[model samples]
Target: MDEALERDCVIAGGGPAGMVLGLILARAGLRVTVLEKHEDFLRDFRGDTVHPSTLTLLGELGLRERFLALPVTALSTLDGVIEGQRITLVDFGALPSPDDFLVMVPQWDFLNFLAREARRLPTFELRMGTEATGLLHEDEDRQPLEEKAWDVDAAVRGLRATSPSGVLEIRATLTVAADGRDSGLRRAAGLIPEESGVPIDVLWFSLPKPPDPTPPTLGHLSSAGMVLTIDRGDSCQSGLIIKKGEFTQMRRAGLDAFHARLTQAAPVLGPVVGTLTEWRQVKLLTVQMNRLPHWYRPGFIAIGDAAHAMSPMFGVGVNFAIQDAVALANAIVPDLRRGAAPVRTLARVQSRRERPVKVMQRIQGRGHRVIARSTTGRRVLPRPMVALIRLASPALRRVAAHVIGQGLFPEHVHTGSVTPRGGHGEVGGVPETWSKTRLWHNEGN
Candidate 1:
């Protein structure tokens, strides 16, 4: 094995949660290393919605000006066609600004922006094309302890990983699993999410953004199928929701039948549905709404999807994941004095985030049932739901926007920048490479 590397914290998975936490901690002058299996952040069909809560956090970091300058579409409202009747689901105009509208930026741009900011700090190090194979603990079956600091008993000490070079070890005072729904770190730590019995999955594909300007975001619900269109400037990111384990049936019916069902739901797309010539462009996302009963064990804690796998409800996941990072930073900022945080310290993270996650999951679960039934027959809203929505009206619009945009308990940045441990002043001075290679510093064997 390669000689082990050491840091104050080692984060497995470089999703929003991991990246944000790494940035905050590094800014606090704590050594943090984030390992990502993927060499770059460019991935299709991933969550891209930057909710108001995340925007507010970015603003608190004093990075919002540069972030907002990026190519993004701000959505003031979420309008959907339910059986040809247009309904304004959530209205951002009712809320306050900067935090009012939902910003739809490409997920890669958002990640890269955060990564660049973290790179400005000397304590931050990100290793791409690196995969964590297993967890390391200070228990009976521990690896050869080359470092004296990790000799004590703890549920987790670090991680065993492999990269382009070879197998190596990363020893951290605190280990974080910010990996996604199919989290390798969570599995290595023996943590699994409890399913909330969701009944739908999504087939994601892209269509050309209409030449005629349409709503920045659109949701169309029909009896046969449901599809959402996200305006990404040049192209529209489309998602078709179907019943769980039903992709096979969809495929067996052929792309023609699938296209017909989807088009029937939203006739505006009739012109472009023909452009989806092949099935290769489509991808499937297995929907899940779940949370871990125990989010931490001694030296380790899981955050974001690693702790709670949310459905693609309102695409609020990116927001929640970022919120997790902010809350974690708030709870553990004081513990930076110690080489590793106390095991009991993780409970603060779980406790602060659990209620908000459960509340969101409950709403998603109900939405799944409603959508599933609608997909089975002629598109029709239940009478009670219609009556309830009509009665609620504008109030419901505001409530939905608040819940989806800001979440139950939004997080803010409280920790300030600290001096680097090595006495480095105002961490800067990295190479100025701009291409994909710029994302990683390849360490040779």
Candidate 2:
């Protein structure tokens, strides 16, 4: 066992929520460590759309230009196709500056960008290839991991994570679990998300993008299934929505039928369907829409997918998570800097952000249920309504575009200093680097 390390805050999972929180808090001069179970952010079937709200926050940090220099496909308009007729679904061009369009970058690239930026903070330590296994309370006040307490959670002092160096205890004034839906820390803390009754699953895979430098994002509905294609320069990240728990039957029906359905749904995309050859290429994402009844315990809090697992309908999952991080940092940076973790302050973070999340989830749950009921039709709206909306499409598109581009409660960046120009994206100070060969622990005094 390596010697235990201490930090102002220990965050589990280096996803958008955790990384963003680490970056902001460290900028406010708090010692923070982010633990990521994976060695790299190369996971596929992830939310990649960078919404307007996130872009605004990036611009506030003055890293917007640096970040946008990376490869991306900007989607200015969202459209839907039915029976070969195209209709504008959402137009982003009418939205605010710096983030009117949704930019489709690979999930890996987005994560790498955040990680690189976070590393520029002297107080932020990101440890990949490590995972939180259990929670810790002050002293022996920690409860057993198996016990379930609906209204109570141990005032977490820190957590234990398994790393290449063996089990190392991380002690912190505050601990945050941002580890996604199946979060181990959330379970250990006895936190559960209340189901919002969303009913849909997605089959995701990659297909060739159109030759254009920027392809319009398209949604196609057919008698068979609804397919969505988001352009990513060389490839399009495609997803087919199916009824909840229907993947087994879809597979039993065979891949040929699936390919046929894809072709029938969007003949424009037929040429690229052949690229998705093997069953191995297809990935199933079990959609979930739920939020925690309570997002915090005494010394700990849950954010992002750890607190709420969202449906993938609007591609706002990552954007919402980023919002949570911004809100959390703005609310708690002072306490962390002062060596305190007040439960009331943590509760306020959830209270402020919960309404927008609930509103988005309700919209998604209702929309998905409606989509599930339409089978004989090739479009979500009735033919008459589709035609009617098209008559006033320009006006309707802008309204929906604002909701998707800038969320109900968009969060702004509060505190993150731009990295020094001389160093190559690395901050001046050294952070604790824990490894099996040599255990390194550095905390700003």
For every model shown, the clashing-pair count is: 0, 0
TM-score of 2: 0.91
Who wins the TM-score comparison? 2
TM-score of 1: 0.90
RMSD of 2: 5.1
User: Where is model 1 poorest over a 10-residue stretch in terms of lDDT?
Assistant: 432-441
Model 2 clash pairs?
A: none
- Tens-place lDDT digits, model 1, residues 70-186: 999888888877665567888877777767888888899989998887877667888899988777876535543333233224467788888988987987878899988888778
Clashes of 1: 0
Which residue segments of model 2 deviate by more than 4 Å?
A: 141-153, 210-215, 374-379, 416-445
Candidate 2 residues 1-445, lDDT tens each? Answer: 4758889899999998898888777666677899999999999989998887888887766667787899987888888775345778888888877678888888889889988876766667899999998877766444554563434644788888899879878989999999999999998888778887656788899888754423365677655568888777777788888777888998899888888888776666776787777888999998888899999998899999999998888899999999999999888876776789899999899998998999998889788876775443445667777678778888888998989889997888655342332355324233322221111235431
